[model samples]
Target chain A: MKTDEKTRAPVARIPDADVPGTVERMRKGERRAIASVITELERLSAAAPALLRSLQPHLGHALVVGFTGPPGAGKSTLVNAIIAQLRQQGRTVGVIAVDPSSPVSGGAILGDRIRMTAALDDDGVFVRSLASRGYLGGLSPAAVRIIDALDGAGYDVVLLETVGTGQNEIDVAEVADIRVVIAAPGLGDDIQAMKSGLLEIADVIVVNKADRPGAEQTLQQLVGALSIRATMSDKVPVLKTSAINGEGVPKLIETLDQLGGKVRAEDAVSRRRRRARYLIARAASDIVANRIKAGSKGGLDTLADSVLSGTMSPHAAATRLLED
Target chain B: MKTDEKTRAPVARIPDADVPGTVERMRKGERRAIASVITELERLSAAAPALLRSLQPHLGHALVVGFTGPPGAGKSTLVNAIIAQLRQQGRTVGVIAVDPSSPVSGGAILGDRIRMTAALDDDGVFVRSLASRGYLGGLSPAAVRIIDALDGAGYDVVLLETVGTGQNEIDVAEVADIRVVIAAPGLGDDIQAMKSGLLEIADVIVVNKADRPGAEQTLQQLVGALSIRATMSDKVPVLKTSAINGEGVPKLIETLDQLGGKVRAEDAVSRRRRRARYLIARAASDIVANRIKAGSKGGLDTLADSVLSGTMSPHAAATRLLED
Candidate 1:
């Protein structure tokens, strides 16, 4: 997975049989082959199911970690530091930056992803930006499939980065075996985003930009918040990291390694199964939404009318729609 | 609706017959009654369908306007200015602040909503906050129901304010008759959020905090951004508003009035129907997610096994599950 000599090659369409070949190369750690599989998934091509099927034997081999926080928390820098440390340890890392691109604040995350990817020249680290705009539900289709690609490509670790406390991010982040939430010193408003919900999902909380003033206060605040939680407090660790100077990163990586060590053979099977369930449910939701929105079906408009008139509960109407 | 003498009353449980009475009082613009209906909806009570059904005849009279932007855009302040002007024009207003509560930034929007509501002493204005956390989809059931309650209560206008660019906010915002997206001067990253997608949906773009430095540059930048968009550029009007001094608010109100005028009775009918579809779809999605997550059904595991092994696609499995 080193520097590609084919950097200047023109694109050529792969025959159906060779699509499976690309998947094989992807499994053997060829960067271009992995990228090709990802491109097919992003295109929502007919080859996706076949590719994923081809990836089945190789699934759940890598440790998947999720990192999330509000903007200005230095999430990108922190992720970079983690990548550097992982590379030094002779581990290949795959990065998926889930862009929570809502209509109002759409492209901001894209810039961060570009910058993060550009800074990493090592072939062992592959980073891709997943635009989550226009998606009506949690984690996009490409995200789940791409994770499989990276994992199947024999990467030692996969890093998922999202820069917001959004429902989309939460759904995406939950897929990871480890979830890391980061905050910078003195970004109190950023912490507020964490207090109600994000803190609940965090496995490891990092006070990024620890060189800044109030880093201790931020770290203490996170600890205090985690302590009040009934379940995750004792399990979750809070660390301080100045990503700019690489201070405190080794401990963070060590924590990650310890946490990564906890995932056993059985847990991987369950994780793969959970991902399957997510894919199926998301597909079902889309199917239901499309059928309801189209109103071209005979009975849907009547059900909607029943709902509008308050004669039927939405839950009941949905039950009928699904069961009938 | 003004000056409730019954504010100190104990929380009394309403009988089933009397629950309908509260809905009637809500339709007649009684503040306590409206609050009661909203509370019931929030509780996801058994009486919600009947309350909503009782509200059907009163739907679609009020002009619905949505305002959204990044945090720190002075959304609360601008909304307050709009409320004051709306009250001065003898228009009763209902405000629904859609809080895009993600795990990390959960309670911040709640604080903004509380402050906005506290400042409004007029009985003619009502504001409610709806949390959009822990949801896997866009918008929430309570938010949709609350809009009906306010609309049915004879408010002349309903204002929706969302604190961020999240999918939940986007869905909630789309329910408005006229969508207004706000921005402030020199928040370059904030504007980056808009440039990708929010500018396209904006019916009226307001550069709030016009008193801030570089307001003109911001205005020109937005105008240039709008110019590049083929459809919305001609229709969308970018205006500057010094929400602190109420500068440009009257014009903003005038713009709202003009835009609100274009939504005819037929459009209102279609809009209500769309809301019904959203409700049904959400309910269906919830049902699907629950069922898939439970793994309780007999055949689901088999289907999931096929998916895990890549023998079948997610969409195909969903189709078989639904259609079977």
Candidate 2:
């Protein structure tokens, strides 16, 4: 389902007054343009839609990989190692680390950005930290748009790292081409993975900090748990890595490359279709919610008062709002 | 503003043909009717709207208390102890335990239900477990509706227990009139409460398992942390309770009663108004999302394919759908 060169040709000369120039600059790998576009998208500025439309033709070139696990799992260290490996292969990378719990000025965001110093100095790598502006999921609502911009800006791979603690965090699986679920020894009992609902969505399970005493036991437990589920066409591999000592990172990278290749070769169309559907649906919901909020105009407060005073039911009030 | 008796007169005889009979049965404390209505609401049945409209007059009578904390914080045990205390005071209680990760038939649900055997055996207690149904938060989308139904069904108190693992789970604060944030000794480092985003929303902080060695340190840490935040009119209390042996349970109950009383006596109308607004807003979002899903026939699929094949951007696709 790849677009033919003829179809791609039209995008090279997009005439949109708000976007064409910036898109051209971004496509030339202009870092400032890329950053500005991302900032606009993050702020949901009026020009974001036009910019995204202009950049559409150049998107879909980057492989988006998602890393999710419980906090304190050494995901940052592992991500740094992976970035180093990808850099060695001459691949440009972009990273979005999502913190759901942090406020806008929270130190956690600064800490995460500082910890990625290994990639900060490299021109081939870019890193950003996104805090939820009261959004439920760890990732910002504009994450998909930013990822698209990164893809269009000639990044070869985009890494998404989120704290896997709630059902909303599981949404990362829908956005990424390859989903890695990281676990650490002694985090909790074996049932922790199952309880967090991570085992089901994991494309690859990495037992990080494998030098710890319980690492082998945890690995076996995860493997055993994975086997009990009905096997899928692609068997999910449980790998061990010690991010502290950099052991087994190369193997993990190789596995990721092979898996990414297989996915691109075999199921890219279907996967992209699914991701597109999810993104559109989510965007539609956000639009509708915003519209409702904008239109309420003290009407919601009156209706709420009526419900509280027992003159109208919450359902009836909601129905009335929807009707309006 | 509290409605006068004259204003409440008409509600005594809601003439809605679809819901009068069931509402009557539920108001009479018929357990079967209450259970059936809740099940219908959970399933989002067609009759739910009518039922809720009829039940509206009887709603706003229950005190909704929310208990949330990290996993393994002994929240269930504390809730169980609270239920016993409330029951001893001759108050009927309704319990909703939310598990975000559980599948429909997951053992966690069963395990939670089993743990509440003490309450299940009593006629004064009605217990229900809600799985996320892939909802982002542990709470079911129908949770507010179910709570209203319970309130209408003559329950004096409604208890909502959820795992505080992500930002979405914080939605419990909207639904509950009084929120209890639980922590336990040796759960993790002192920063655990802050990381979970529990400290900001806690109306009451309970240090469960207070018999542990580090309980004093944890309690002092929590107190110190709480001191840093600007104080409100009513200082949020930090209580210590060892739910294992029932120590501190009575005092906890006393504190709850006093707080609940204060809330009801001082700001019941405002609180109910706020809750109603939240419910209506959430309901509107759900309704709009559902309408979008229902309205998009093969149109969405086509748009998604276009986005995937790079013929259109996701933002453009979403805009098209919203316009339609």
Candidate 3:
């Protein structure tokens, strides 16, 4: 009878067969249960579906805030400082640091996580570093699932932090309710880099390390650049922070709180719907990839022939398939 | 007649209308023509398709070699040294440095490219820095198209250099005929990092910075790790190179040449077909994104609803979408 576990559907598996019991324990702030659920979901064990289903109703409780910036933007320092501010407010926090590095720096990423989160001894603060192993490398589906897991476990806030400003890193912004794009002075072309990609996604922009020499110029450039763009009618607060000194953090927290109630106040159903949309989009991409792998997709062979023969561009053929 | 330019399709646009002439010049080793054609294609200007079509018959001339590793692995120094050795053989080389950094350091990527390729003043050497502005942090469709441009322009070899080993960065492996994953001593956990991800895609692995202490140990670990991996049927040659001292590079080049002819020997048709498959797969991802944006893709809403309601896991819902 125990061997029957192998033949059963993934939703009916053992670790997750105790889904309800785990969920109950996790909600009561049992740290082990919370960690177990996240680990099983991240590894995509067979029990993930049942665990996810059980955790669904508890989703959307935590306000997911994302922090991102260029490599030298002092994001980890800012994140640690923000964690301190959050802890001071007596809010339980779960920090998920998602860095999809080249496969060569696994130890370096762990080293980074520990260094950033080392001092917090409070049980209310749980830190998990997610190495983005997704196809594109920013926030993976596992991170998405883990966010829900943290939310279900009753964390008051979930901070999603991603390293770098690559295309995939920008994607981390999509999942957060409040997206904060960080910048620092004297790191040349980062502001230009922001102008091209990160500026648009930012709900709140921070010029960290404001004590640096060119901080004022950097702030003005950002403000000027934001003014020229008419996309977001609401003013995106551009603030300066000296993360080392803890200066400007309290103001930052105040601004975040002001933005929070309005952003996170959407009804539970709508909030869940927004997440559903992002999830479905990710799923659709995976479906296309699998179909491509199978290689017998309807007209893909013919379309590839057309591309090689110069009758159609690769993109135009893909569009034709979608239309069909 | 000038007014008509506004309404015409991209294929028939001005810069691209001279596609045939441009291709003729580029094929004849005209550096300006090569640069111009590549510029137009990279920007995806109105004339890209026509330009691409014109270059079709001329593709697959150069052997594309990809160099990737973790940050501080000396990828730039190694690539530059290889370029010098390739130049010693009187072969023309085109080096494309693709770094999809977190958006903050536009200036830094440029600086690295200059430092890597600065000493080479030969007309036979063409070096371009491509900041990966792709959706993910690694290789993009633009990189694929530009590779064809370089190949058609008749560079004897194309060296593709991507910074770091993000998920997207490993993607540089896909387009290259020969994939070289580099490692170095003194990089903590980099060897461990390779075992998990970089090892699988590596055609020829190198323990770069071989002059450093622990070089032998890193090399042993790489060999041991490769032995354990069963996916790669052919023995992947592991070499050691000191980019600073120029030691072991000649053997490295010899190994690459031995692997190159066999890998690149496939007829132009199959070569084009391989490239087409990659392009089509990327297009499929884009198509899915557009469908998600349009929000009317058949039954996506229903799938999202099911996902939101916890009746189906996000991935299961995606699988169902593909089945439908």
Q: Which pairs clash inside model 2?
A: none
Candidate 1 per-residue lDDT, tens place, B197-239, comes to 5565678989998998998888887787676656767898999
lDDT of 3 by residue, A269-311 (tens): 5665666667667667757756675676447778876665445
**How high is the lDDT of residue B199 in model 1?**
65
TM-score to native of every candidate shown: 0.79, 0.66, 0.77
Model 1 C-alpha lDDT per residue in residues A1-324, reported as the tens digit of each score = 122144321233444588778977787778788888887666545555567667777877888898876556777788888888888889899988766454434454466656656455577888887766432344665676778788888888999886443445656666788888777776434244434455656778888989999999878877876766658778989999999999999999899889888864456667876777777887887787777777564687788777665456678888998887
* Model 3's TM-score against the true structure: 0.77
For every prediction, compared with the true complex, DockQ reads 0.35, 0.22, 0.25
Find the candidate with the highest lDDT and give its number.
Answer: 1
The CA-based lDDT of model 3 is what? Answer: 0.71
Model 1 docking grade: acceptable
Best-matching candidate per DockQ: 1
Give the whole-model CA lDDT for all candidates, comma-separated.
Answer: 0.72, 0.68, 0.71
I-RMSD for candidate 3: 5.8
Fnat per model, in the order given? 0.41, 0.31, 0.26
